[model samples]
Target: MRKYLIFIFIVLAVAGCKKKNKAVTSTIPGKPALTTPAQNSVCISGTIISATESQVLFTWNPAVNTDSYDLVLKNLLTYTSTTINTIDTKINATLLRNTPYEWYISAKQNSSSTTTQSDGWKFYNSGAGIVSYPPFPADIMYPAFGQVITPSNGKIELYWAGNSVGNNIASYTVCLGTTSNPPAIKNGLTESQLKDVAVTANTTYYWRIITFDADGNYTDSGLFQFKIQ
Candidate 1:
């Protein structure tokens, strides 16, 4: 009888151990969700901004949950990308002068997640704008040459010589005015074609051509001043 009692007690203890282990194994917690990073976000908008030979200065709106931003530089042709720098706020990177550089920003929410990429922007050391301005509509050519020919209709027939390099001429922005302050802007044009544009007789118009390369850096032409007769 004593042996049987002892055996029964051991069986009960083993069953209790099994029950405790099962409870602990079934109560495991779920993993936490990953933090979301803001996508492809970058801004250079600010007041009193300028770029020197070696650096650029600009400000942007802060992002939510972002600990910092990653600045990336990419070669337009080869599709090679490199992380040039990381910063908690705006940046002024020392860059090669007069070279075309493509850059963009990505937000780092934390160690876990990052935002989607913001749109890329381009700028030259020569103080050119990032966005491309296509050829002027109603103009004689997409990229108007320095000298123009006046047709019999008393209209100015302008012609644009495309870029000498392999970079395609995306478009041009034709400004018809004396100065840039209040110049009339015409957008979109076919490449390398002559366009007949009407103008007032004996009036001078200042115009320029803005061309976008493959990666979208705009190389602009100096202002071409002409007169209508």
Candidate 2:
């Protein structure tokens, strides 16, 4: 009788253990932190592939609950982008020399469908015999291309961000009008924003930014447009 009671107790304990959940807990992926080719800095350490290209090493800190990372590298001059996937923290890529580029990392996990992206960083790929770099094309921050907005105050602000090697920026030129090729409405502005620009309702406007370095090198921000409702 004593042996039977011990066997029943063991069976009951096994059943209790089997009832517990075996699945692991899950959480959203954290944003990756960039390490090398630091933000808004020049990248001078790389193997020279040729007069037009160089191999760059990209490194970043690991994010929590991330299983993989996708590196997005964009040529700011040509407006072209490349995507690379890896399960590691660092990678080597060959890119165009003497050009400005921006990069970011997207983190993903197999257990979840969501993804996290890290902040973007811009760098100039220095090549042999290169002396200076032009400012990166101004990044349009407000009223994105083709965005429709209503100006309650009869005006809207235009803003942009610019960067260059050695911080050699001189001024920015803002061109705005209804035509695709707008004329310069403002020039030699040292600020990043244009405030209190009057607008008309139910009209589309086109604009672009021209960034000039202190050495007279200039880069266009390309064209962007928005509609006022």
Candidate 3:
């Protein structure tokens, strides 16, 4: 026969080219499964609804398949930190006053290799109750900034500030007066207490800081004139 039918047609064309090269090397091409895992990392939850004296409105909660998101704003009294706001899906670190801020957030995974750090936040900038930071002054925190320390000897160290205008520090009020519009006795004042009171020195104490919200509905940061030195 013609050389065994051309050697059986070249052995069935070399076994059909070795079964099409073993079906194209057993079909390979896989990679896609990493939905934030370094043990399910990345989390941040902080809120400061609204504030003024420039700006500082915050909100957070978004990260499920993240491919981008990183914001950092730290200046808790000038500890300095800013410049890192990459967002392809979530962002908010706009500030210009209303001090006291500390933030943190991170989550990026385009098939992650590594990059995850979230869970850090601190906030306090309660401005816009219409012009803040000027009513906690009966020498409020003027220990070395105004020279007026009195309310002496029972160990008086009272400082007030919370009519909330621009650097919102929303808590403070230590009263015990002699007329200057001071007579709030529900047992004699105690709301959002920040402790330090045992007055009776050079006595001439009259205080006020009723910026309220426990449903006692307040907003009175007038009257602060100390004397306990």
Task: Using lDDT, rank the candidates from best to worst.
Answer: 2, 1, 3
Q: Against the true structure, what is each candidate's TM-score?
A: 0.35, 0.86, 0.21
Candidate 3: residue 217 Cα off by (Å): 13
Q: Candidate 1 residues 34-89, lDDT tens each? A: 12111122222222234534454423455555566676765333345777445445
Residue range 1-229, candidate 3, lDDT tens digits: 9999999999999999999897765222122222211111111233444443343334445566566656666654455788565544344454544454556666666655566656654544434442323222222443333245654445544444333223344344454465677775323243344345665655566665455433333444445565655
Q: Lowest-scoring 10 consecutive residues by lDDT in candidate 1?
A: 32-41
Q: Identify the superior model by TM-score, candidate 2 or candidate 3.
A: 2
**Candidate number achieving the greatest TM-score relative to the actual structure:** 2
CA lDDT of every candidate:
0.49, 0.91, 0.47
The alpha-carbon lDDT assigned to residue 96 of candidate 3 equals 42
Cα lDDT of model 2 by residue, 10-63, tens digit: 999887776654333456899999998988888889898888888999999999
